[model samples]
Target: MSSAAYERIRNNPKFDKLVATRSRFAWTLSAVVLILYYGFMAVVAFNPTLLASPLGEGRIATIGWPIAALMMLLFWVMTGLYVHRANGKFDEINAELIKEATKEAQ
Candidate 1:
């Protein structure tokens, strides 16, 4: 694409909104993952016994195992969520922005 096209898109409010929305979403997801993982680590560091406790009277596995698994699953789910939103909403807006930019340039 030409510099003019790039400049046109860069100046578009839709382009700015796309960047802002994507950045906010990515940061939010990162914060959630950090909080969850760090919180888990903090618990393990400060209160190891809590995470070490068995799931039930006779169970061998600790509760932490499942919680950790869930955290991992959460990361995957968040990834999918971003991908879905990017493909559906963000991409649509981006295409529209490009079309507008091209029209404006022409």
Candidate 2:
């Protein structure tokens, strides 16, 4: 195995810290989203009748429809949050690592 590159970055405290923090946030966020989604689905599954009933008069929507819509919205928001963090923070770290590696090679 060649160790010509990444030697300095491997020992960089900043890079290691950034990676640890990013990984922690990424995993925690993913778990929270999964738990929420499954929990909601489980609730609906156990109580199928809850969504079947209409919220109010004929004009009102079904209870389940709104809940599903809210879940979708929440998922979309979570996706956006993940993208924002990945692009802003994670990618920045990656770019720095690459820049330092290339500089060291030259």
Candidate 3:
């Protein structure tokens, strides 16, 4: 709550590790989603017929439909993965840092 406590947390090595690890994970997930989305868009832009084509000889659905759905599901899974790690490992490290800082402040 105090500035000194904040400074103490900021100066902690665990705090730096937490920030670096979380940022790296977030960026990695972001890059994966971006690549998937943009790659799909590129396909749609350059090869519309490929995506537009039907899934099978008699199927009404296009191949792109399943691909898009899978991409959406994958994104959700990635989100869950991030949340799991954040709530687990990240939170543990954060709690430790906070407790340490508070103790040092006292």
Candidate 4:
């Protein structure tokens, strides 16, 4: 059987490279964020006092609000990072693929 879908996609080296790059980046970012967020939660869970104390207070600005704000900020930052990379790099790859496919079809 012919693998038209696979072949069509694989024929474009840039497409594969782009996909791999995006996948790697996404995985790495996810792991980092997951580790940081979950690690914080785990520490907090284990030692509630640590997160609630003045010195060991989870966040800088006021403990509770600060921690919440920090988490929101971090999540937004990650989202922005992903959007930037996807638009700058992945979109280029996608455009090239579409152009090539259209050309081939014509």
The TM-score between candidate 2 and the true structure equals 0.77
| lDDT value, candidate 2, whole model | 0.82
Each model's lDDT comes to: 0.93, 0.82, 0.96, 0.77
Candidate 3 on 1-106: residue-level lDDT in tens? 6999999999999999999999999999999999999999999999989998999999899999999999999999999999999999999999999999999977
Q: Write the per-residue lDDT of candidate 1 for residues 36-82, one digit (tens) a residue.
A: 99999999999999988999999999999999999999999999999
TM-score of each: 0.90, 0.77, 0.91, 0.77
Give the distance in Å from residue 22's predicted Cα in candidate 2 to where it truly belongs. Answer: 1.7
What is the RMSD of candidate 4?
Answer: 4.0
TM-score of 1: 0.90
Indicate which candidate wins on lDDT: 3
Off by over 4 Å in 1: none
lDDT value, residue 18 of candidate 1: 97
Find the 10 residues in a row with the least total lDDT in model 4.
Answer: 53-62
Which segments of model 2 are wrong by more than 4 Å?
A: 57-60
Q: lDDT value for candidate 3?
A: 0.96
Candidate 4 overall lDDT versus native: 0.77
Query: Quick one: best TM-score, which candidate?
Result: 3
